[model samples]
Target: MLVLSRRAGESVVIGEDVTITVLEVRGDVIRIGIDAPRSVAVHRAELLEQLETVNREAASPSEDAVQSLSAALRSRPGNHAG
Candidate 1:
């Protein structure tokens, strides 16, 4: 892990396009601003973790769930199930 101490208004650059700047410091909480191109994605760690968990769950469906979904879709109007 890279560790650096920066005051408000100070910034660190990554490669040629990304910049992480410290915006404010209030006691123990620090606010930061990031500058990156639209192609880049930035997400809070917890949110990213949650998304990963949801993706994993969706990827692996239980047999009961698959059966329930299949039944529901097959029961729809104008739909046929084999």
Candidate 2:
């Protein structure tokens, strides 16, 4: 990990297009701003972990399980007898 010091309104550039800036500092809390292209995704550590967990769960589904779910939904009777 590369460490650098930045003051409020100062920024650091990552790669070619990404920029991270120090927006505010209050005692121990520091607020940061990021600028990146739409194609790039940025998330907090906890949120990223949640997304990874969801993706792992999605990728581990069995084909038969998915087909069974589809069949169950299709077989459900709809109420149209009003």
Candidate 3:
């Protein structure tokens, strides 16, 4: 990991589109601001991990199976009428 020292209000550029700036520093926590295009997604590390897990679960074939089962239920006799 690359680490750089930045004071409050200092900023670092990421790639060509994202900027991370130090907004405030308290005793143990530091607040930061990020500027990026709307198309870019930003999340905390833990939240990103959770989102990745959820996305993987959603993209798995089991989810497709579940959807198929739901469709089958809706198509069963007495479940819907033409």
Candidate 4:
């Protein structure tokens, strides 16, 4: 990671559009402001991770769901073996 030190009121620019500005520094906590275009997506790291986990769980079929689907397919009208 590229690390740089900036005091409050100092800003860092990324690409040609995004700007990250330090707003306040209180003890160990620091507050920052980001300026970007509407098309750019900015998300907190932890929140993004949570969203990814939820999406993965939703996309994957459970064992019970797979079994139920298999059973339904086996019992369908034209699916029987002669």
Q: Pick the candidate with the highest TM-score.
A: 1
Worst 10 residues of 2 by lDDT: 73-82
TM-score of each: 0.74, 0.62, 0.60, 0.72
lDDT of 2: 0.93
CA lDDT scores, all candidates in order: 0.96, 0.93, 0.92, 0.96
TM-score-wise, the better of 2 and 3 is 2
lDDT of 1 by residue, 1-82 (tens): 9999999999999989999999999999999999999999999999999999999999999999999998899899988657
Candidate 2, residues 1-82, lDDT tens digits: the string is 9999999999999999999999999999999999999999998999989989999989899899899987877777993443
Using TM-score as the measure, name the better of candidate 1 and candidate 3: 1
- Candidate RMSDs in Å, in order, are 2.9, 6.8, 5.2, 2.9
Off by over 4 Å in 2: 53-82
Give the Cα-based TM-score of candidate 4 against the true structure.
0.72
**Model 4 per-residue lDDT tens digits across residues 12-81:** 9999999999999999999999999999999999999999999999899899999999888888998866
User: What C-alpha root-mean-square deviation, in Å, does candidate 1 show against the real structure?
Assistant: 2.9
Kindly provide the TM-score of model 2 when superposed on the true structure, using C-alpha atoms: 0.62
In lDDT terms, how accurate is model 3? 0.92
Local distance difference test, candidate 4: 0.96
User: What's the best-to-worst order under lDDT?
Assistant: 1, 4, 2, 3
